[model samples]
Each structure stands twice: as structure tokens, then as C-alpha cells.
Target: MNMLEVFVSSLEEFQPDLVVLSGLHMMEGQTKEMRQKRLLEAVASISDIPMGVPVHLELASMTDPELMSAIIHQQVFPLVNSVGLNEQELLFLTQAASGPHASLASWNGVPDVGVVSDIVFWILKEHGRTPGKASDLTRIHFHTLAYHLLVTVDGYWANQVAAVAAGARVAGTQACATQTIDASRVFLKAPLEFATSKMEEASTVSLNPHEPVSEWHRDGVTFHYTPVLVCKDPLRTVGLGDAISAEGLLYSEIYPH
Candidate 1:
């Protein structure tokens, strides 16, 4: 906690292009009062980030609804420009926020793209960047075994196709524990055709292998989807989400640059 406070206080000296916060779930065992104090400090430090320098919050498995709610409603979520999470974290956020499909306890398999898309859309519309609001969130990079979804407010982000593809590619290499992908071991598991949302009138998007990346626009947001080359035999699954998020961010281009 002391180290974090010192680093955050020195942001002007570092002048970073991006800031990412992860592993808050590490505080699970702390007493409520202690956790509250640290979180309050964290929120205060994050608020000190200079305007226009994008921040990304990466979420992990957190079972406590109270902690999740505090991060979502009171402080953290409102200040970050982007977020990265898997299906479980996404469902938990929806559940905590009382948003769409809040009743689902867990997913049976790779979640349906439409359901994921709907939830991602709901998050941005309900909690993300809005006129006169403090929330700066405009981008969500959601990863699953089957696919990766990069959703962003249209004007704030650019080059979605490359970013999504880079994330999907890293999932294979990282899981297989190889710097270069082994073609015989990796196979695509994502659906070729998927609906944009769960709505009755939602549009269906079909993947073209030649292009691989499929994109759609809804309301004021744009979604980019790419099928992951899943590893048939995995050496390790740990850190896959982090690797995916990091690679995606590396390729991501902030608009108006």
C-alpha cells in the first residue's frame, strides 16, 4: 500500500502513456475496515492521474459483492478509460450492478457471443463515458477461450481489427508456452456466425477467415471480434488473460493521435 501510494504520487515524473491496475482480489482476506481504508487511498491516488492519460483496470475473480460494488459505483470504474475481464468477472460485474442477465450464476461453456455483447454494451451505456459524467470509461477488452471482444466508444479509439487479432493470437502462444504458435496444436473454436446482441432484432455477424476480424457498430459504440486459435494441448492456462489484455493494449491506438 505504501509503495503504491508513492508511485501514484509520482505519476507526473514518470509521464506514462497508459496505467493498468490489476490483482485487487489480492486483498480478499483483509478485514473490512482495512480494505476500505486501502481502497479509499487507491481511489484518491487514481483520481490524481492527469487528464487525457488513459488508465485501464484489469479485473480478476472477486467473490465479495461489497468490494466489487465499491469499485464499480463509488470510485475506480468511473475513473478508468478502459477495463479488461473474462466472462466470470463480466458476469459478476453485471450481477453487482443489477444490469442485464444478472440472474446467471455461471456459464456452461464459452459464453454465447450475443449474451457477452449485450452485457458489454449495457456496461458502456450504463456506466461508461457519458456527457457531463465523471466516468471516462470508453473501452472494454473482453477475452474468453473462444474469442476476444474489443468494444469502444467510436470517437475515442482506433484500429480495432489489429488489436482484437493480436489478443487472440497471444492466447494461443501463451497457453501453449511457446513464442511461436504450433499450427497442428491450435484450432479455432469460436463460432463463425454470431448475433450482435440477444435482442430479437439484433444483427448477425459472420466471420470471414480471410479477414478473420468481424466488426459492427451499435448506438455510439463499435465492436471488434476475432476468433481465438485455441490450443489443443495446453502447457499452462495461468496469465492468459493478462497476456491477452497486454497484447491487445499494445496494438491499440488511441484516437486523435
Candidate 2:
């Protein structure tokens, strides 16, 4: 079987409560605002799934405080109840909302294309240039190091509540299009109690903008859907399909039944 068949089978059988559009692993965007907008719109368009629920996402960036806030205000506020960010991300988020890069990037020698929250902090401390309470973006249920937290299906994240526990914290079985994390961000394993006995057919994999992948595979199978998952041969990149085999069979005690 192929990777597409595997993922589709999983989705068809599990029927997860919510879906997470795994950002393809790459980062060369215009800005956080633009990227946030694209991400939000894409997630809003998934066909079969509940729209209202908290979602867990894995990220890796250098410093993009404003960009992160853009995601919160533009996409999350309405669709998501809360979000999860690492300590550094939280710091930048506070600064970015206020129009200052916040410089949260240098907190741990980690630098990327993210905003700097400290810029706002310094400005507020010294210049006081903030026109108004531009930094009143604290209306969120933020969790630190959510990546680490999601590594296990313990009681802390037993319910898949995005950043908290409620009920539906389910993630789509699709591969992330442009997912970049400072470290590894893996969703905990749910024993494969439920399995797709057999796949019927392979579906075409279509990736939206701002989405890229490193390796697309399924159950140890590699996907090769040209023009859909990868770049030109010389400038090749992988899609979510390559992350697993077409038949992503696993030995989990509890499947998504």
C-alpha cells in the first residue's frame, strides 16, 4: 500500500474529533502576519471535522513575537480556546502584540526569523512609545513547552485539550506542511487499538501554501507524488506523505477506535 492510503485509512477509521494541519517543515515566509493568515485560512477549510476545539501544535522558530500574536488574534481567538507555547515563545508573544519584536529570540541563544518581544519591553521601559495599551494580548490559556507535554499521553494531556484538558484535543493524521520546532515536537502515541484492516485506494496529496516537508513516509513507506509534495528534483523537499508509508500500520494497543 502507499502512504496516502495509510493516512486516509487512519482518518476514515479513527474519525478524530479535531484535525491539526501539520505545518510542512520549512520557514522562509514574508512575515508572521502573512504566515498566520495563511495557516488560519487553511485550517478553517478542512472538510470533515469539528471546527470548535482547542488544538495542539508543534512549532520551531527563532524570534517572531508579532507573528505569533498575529496567529493568536487572526486565527486562534475564534477557533481555538487556548494555545501552547514554550517559555521563549510566551515572552515574544507578550512583546510582539505591542509592536516591538520583543527580542525574545536571544533569551537562550536561539535565533530564527521570529519577532523580538524585548523590543517592545525596552521601548515600554524607556521610550514609552506604545501609542496605547497595544500589548493587552493576555487573553489566552498559554502552556509552556507544550511540545514536551505532548510527548506522552499522560493525565496532563490525557484529553488532547490543545493547551489544557477539555475533551477534543484530537490531531489530524495528515503531515504538517511547514512545521519547525526549536526541538522535537511529537504527538504522544495512542495505542493502535483501532486499525484499518485494508486500504481501498490511494488519494492524491495536495499541499497548500506555506507548507513544506522534510521526509514524508507511512509505515516505513516513502511517498513520491511529484509537484504535490516535493520541489523540483534539484531543489527537492518532502511532503507529509513521505513521513510515513502508504500503509502506516503501527503496533499500538489502543487504536483510534
Best by TM-score: 1
lDDT of 2: 0.30
lDDT by residue (tens digit), candidate 2, 146-252? 11111121111222222222101111222322233111333322211221111223333333223221112233122211111211111222332222211111111
State each model's CA lDDT, in order: 0.88, 0.30
How does candidate 2 fare on TM-score?
A: 0.33
Q: How far off is residue 130 in model 1, in Å?
A: 2.2
Off by over 4 Å in 2: 1-13, 18-37, 46-48, 51-54, 99-257
Task: Assess the local accuracy of residue 188 in candidate 1 as a C-alpha lDDT between 0 and 100.
Answer: 82
Give each prediction's root-mean-square deviation over alpha carbons: 1.5, 18.9
lDDT of 1 by residue, 18-97 (tens): 88888678777899999999888888888887877888989999999888888888778888889999999999988988
